[model samples]
Target chain A: MCQLLGMNSKNPADIGFSFAGFRARGGLTDDHVDGFGIAYFEPTGLRLYCDNRAAMDSPLAELVSQTRVKADNTIVHIRKSDDQLLSNAHPFTREIWGEAWVFSHNGKMTIKDAADSDPIKQGKSRHYCPVGDTDSEFAFCYLLNQLKEQFEYKPDARTLYEFLTVQCRFLANYGLFNCLMSNGEWMLGYANTLLFHVTRQTPFGSAALIDVDVTMDFETVNETDDVMTVLATTPLTSDEDWQQLAVDECIIFAEGHMVYQDVPTRPVYLSIEEGLKIAKNA
Target chain B: MCQLLGMNSKNPADIGFSFAGFRARGGLTDDHVDGFGIAYFEPTGLRLYCDNRAAMDSPLAELVSQTRVKADNTIVHIRKSDDQLLSNAHPFTREIWGEAWVFSHNGKMTIKDAADSDPIKQGKSRHYCPVGDTDSEFAFCYLLNQLKEQFEYKPDARTLYEFLTVQCRFLANYGLFNCLMSNGEWMLGYANTLLFHVTRQTPFGSAALIDVDVTMDFETVNETDDVMTVLATTPLTSDEDWQQLAVDECIIFAEGHMVYQDVPTRPVYLSIEEGLKIAKNA
Candidate 1:
């Protein structure tokens, strides 16, 4: 179990207020002291910070509070790995699609070994490859590789949306593969076990971290109409409304506002090429 | 041992050709293959991909080569660990001063235990918090912490320029800590044990990766100046005029060019706060 925090806004913004409370639940006040990380997308670059240490103890968390390294998009994670999961599956790792991709998850997943499920015959494989033996990270790489093989490097935005929805549905069947991803532009949130979100705009209100007493007056944080969406394994605030994510559901939030909502039907395993056909047909 | 590939250009460009050659050196054609990572500063944010596996075998590396993730600034490294540094002390990590800072390094480092060198209770205690347990990484956090303690946040470029040179000089004495750092605007490179660089611009010649034969005519590149600097633990190419760094010296490169150089009389041993004072004084 882990907690995830994300924000997408029209204008660059820091997630210190909401992250403050979310981090407490990971450890400190709560018991999530496994590891923590934060990613901020700046102009043509990113400020990504991670620590095998807890968020509360992370030098990054402290810096996030004091300094505003604003970004239009951001995702944060507080990991809680029980003995059931392998330590190798920690929320940070690199995945390959048509481009270098980064992924972090906040749930448990049991991925299949390709050798057992689908053995490679000779030198013939244009699909996914798993470098690490972790399930969650494997799922991320597998999903992305599927997308890559199907689209062959370029997929329209609409096609990407449908493909991702299908992939999310597929992941939901295997325990919690709840995830968040960014090519560093838009923030994608998928939930199976538990997750919540709140988007702030005009006439915003102050919110408190559920685990911590820290609160910030959103009204005083500039009068601009900025939309910020927050995601977590559980609600970080006692007072705010955190919409529970149904299995096979995903939401695309960009520039701090929700843009796409996907409630998938059922997940059926498909070949990488087959998945692309679905995208092309859709 | 590591291989670092960096590109700085007036316009965003795809680093596929150079990366292809550089990636091959990672435990394939040559040896430095313990881990590898590459980061791209796209038009809006950073797209980073890394793996603790051999770059030659990484699907992530293959994707990076096939898909052109164009960017203005990029850094890639293939690792062969000599110090047995843990992942926490690995080349990729973020440290903060005011703006978000990114750092990566090549080569081994001789880290002195503060407890070993500095007499305990022999003087008033100084405050220093290490974020990780590697000498290379410790130097990164220590430099930033020192700078932050003095300036708090947001210091000028000149101050930063001077401070980094002195700090690099100190860092170089502790064995091989050759490094590269960027704040998404300007880049700084310090050559300690062995690091080489090449800045390409108009009338550029055909440059090829030493590890692989992938080559491109810089003349065809769409940049006012195709300024690129390649730094590595060992010389990657035989043809290029690689500069051998002077022992115990630091060199500053900004905006595709070199601006300052420093050769310290002796290692500057000062408190974190005192070091920041130099940046402030500058």
Candidate 2:
């Protein structure tokens, strides 16, 4: 599998503090060394950095960690490749209705089954398709195509949030579907099993990393009005109260606050034998 | 206006040597310092680095100059933004047929003219549109939309090349239209006024930079079978025999060779007064 990290802020902010620890998992602290990627949305424009090299040793990742590219929304991913190719690197991006939509996944799905039922193959997903051969990208294309089919242009925020929650449930049925998606204006996070989030507001304090010997004093760097929320596959900081999400839960965030959330009415779980069958086909 | 640089190679190659001098024009040597961007096609995937900071001072650009990221096709642009916004940065990319088509322009065109006739505005360009408000991106969207309208999937190389040549002529009629576009497989360069190209092959030798105090001995690093072609708004090296394109000529390059060329039969030059009017509208 892979790891995911995301941030949504009321003001432009840097992820260097969090990224420093998150990237250590790419090779230094853990075994996910296949590749890593990150996407930052500076309002309407986007800055993306991706490398097929291990983030622990990648020069680009080093530069990213040192440079403070401030943005309101950001997503990062580190991969342990089931398919060893640069094309399958995470944080895949696509444009929809003149807005760039970025996505990264942290779990596995049955590629053969997804492709067999792909709307793109059925000629319904004419507007978007996956550039890489990853099941994650295929799932993203399907979801975007469904959105395009439902609305000629972007729908209201509430409508979009509701539609995505229903779609996330359907996708989770295929396999473990933990994902982070953003379109510059808002961020949507879905947890099939493991996900955690933490919000830092006015009374910001010092936070220490769980993976590295690094600590950041937020009070010194941030204004009193600044608010930021971070989401990750695993908690990056040891001192913060990271709220864990339940299985099949989805949350939408904007301007550092949770605007909407959907908690599954009845918990659904897949057995180990069923998961093994999907993995074998994949 | 912006500076454009592109590379097409027979083998995966690093462009650090050429990029070093080109980036100097962003601030140190010239005044095109509003922003800069570069795209590297990694076979089936893409790696893009962009900043709304001066390339001469950007740490990302410094890292790129030192890191040897090998790619078969690469495009870089340094901008002097008439409109100071990150969304207006160069090398705008959109996906077509599951392949990223990257584009950057060096001169201005009348945005009003392009928008009036935009296929997307007419409900025809369903596959792609511009995320930013720039004449360059508007023109790119127009070109890509025309291509998608002509072919359901990617056409043969020859057919696509021929169609692009005709389209370039039409776009050049609107205003100054020197541009570079690529789809990883091939590069197409069109010039309304300024464009130059140089191809380095088996007998490669030392080359001196034009904007920086740097010289590279290519023979030490390249194999005998290596062939690489570079396109730029101005020649980067002082020692190479760079060929200038005619006013309305388009060249298609693949594997460091020019596979096709289209020259206008009769040049249509816009008068200074007419160009001023278009610039004012833009």
Candidate 3:
């Protein structure tokens, strides 16, 4: 199992506060420290930094934490891969329709490369191939391949949301498939077992971190009309309310607001602790 | 009218010394202060950093200079675009055949997006498209599209060199089109107007930077078996004997040694100053 932290803001915002607390889980408060990566979507380009080292110890991570680069959308991951290779680091990116798409996975999937010969897996490696050997990257490529095969150009936000909901549900059948994806314009989060999100708007109050000795007053950081949404595998703050997504649920947030959501019928709820145990045993 | 710096080494080597000199051109030394970027190829992946700010003023570039991340292959660029946008910053990266390809250009081209309808420009935007409006990126997409159309997978280095030599010459017909490209394993440099290179091996001596006051003793930094080749739009070190590539020349370097070189018949020789004037007027 890994850890994920995603942020989407109506305007460019700094993620240092949320990231400071979340990065503590990468071998400081909890152990998910095979590697770590973060992607910050600048106005027109993306800045990606990945290190095959514990986020708590990596100098690159320290640089990222210290340098407050304002971005519209950001994705961070602390990996727990069996093989500590740089290629397996999360927050993989691919360019589609002249836009860069970033993806990160938190849970293990039972899908194997040998099954790529199946009809469903065809063209997965043809249009977009995984540079790494991780099942997460393989799955990301499959998703992009499907999108490319269906559309010659980038589709509208609503169309993409509808397509992604069904595709994400299908992927969850493979196993625990918690993921976060973004193209800078919108963030899509899917939870098979455990994922939580919180939105902060005007009249915001202070929030205390769960893992670190830090408190931030959102009122001071955000402007009058600012809105932002943050998603994580687990809640990073102790005071604010964080809503857990239902199993097999897919949600899309754009401009700091939830635009679409789909919840499967007869969803099976699972606790974070239970999910961690199963992930460890796998 | 940009600046380029590239390195290929037999062993992972620190490029801080050369980068310090090259970065000065972004603001302190010469006026190419539109944007800057650098790509470092790690053992299994790549780390890319780009900033729209002048390299001398960018904190990110300062961090990059302070943190000496060793890499086997590296590419850096300081831009001078009319529109100083982050998207126009080089070096640009694209994934081809599951390998990340990095490219940076220092010259102007007359190629326009309207030319996509031409037979020679077929699939240029379909297979790969430029996110920015720069002619340099458009040319890069065209190059990659041509390579993809011809080869299903990454071809051998020799075959790629031969194919690229022809393609680069064809692109030069549009205008000055000097560029450097790499896929981590090898580096391909083409000089339509101006380019220079220097190689350092055992028994290396000290060299002084032309832009900065720093000097480095290569013998103290490199091992006996280590070899490195540095390529740039202009000679960076004052004391080293740099070799200038002839116009319409294409060269490939791997493991710090030149693997292939092609010089066209009746090649026109242009000085670096002359090339810069032509680029600025473009």
Better of 1 and 3 by TM-score: 3
Q: lDDT by residue for model 3 over B30-140, one digit each (tens)?
A: 888999899988777787878888999887789888988888899999988777778788999888888888999988777873465665467765678887778888888
Cα lDDT, model 2, residue B8: 92
Model 3 Cα lDDT, one tens digit per residue, A1-282: 898999999999899999999889999999988999999888867888788899998777898888888889999999987788887888898888988899999888877834766644678657788888887988888898889888898888789898988778777777778899998999999997788999999888999999999999999888989999999988999999999888888999988999999887777767879866777776
Cα error, candidate 2, residue A226 (Å): 1.3
Weakest 10 consecutive residues, lDDT, candidate 2 chain B? B271-280
Task: Name the better of 2 and 3 by DockQ.
Answer: 2
TM-score of each: 0.49, 0.92, 0.97
Tens digits of per-residue lDDT, candidate 2, B165-250, equal: 88788877766788899888888899876778999998889899999999999999899999999998878999999987777889
User: Model 2: which residue pairs collide?
Assistant: none
DockQ of 3: 0.60
> Which regions of candidate 1 are displaced past 4 Å?
A82-100, A112-115, A118-132, A264-282, B1-282
Q: List, residue by residue over A1-282, the lDDT tens digit for candidate 2.
A: 788999999998999999999999989898788888989998648888888878898887888887788899999999877555667888888877888899998788764465655533454347676777887887788788888878888899999999998877777777778899999988899987777899998899999998999999999999999999999987899999988776788998899999998877785544435433443443
Task: Please give me the DockQ of candidate 1 compared with the native complex.
Answer: 0.02
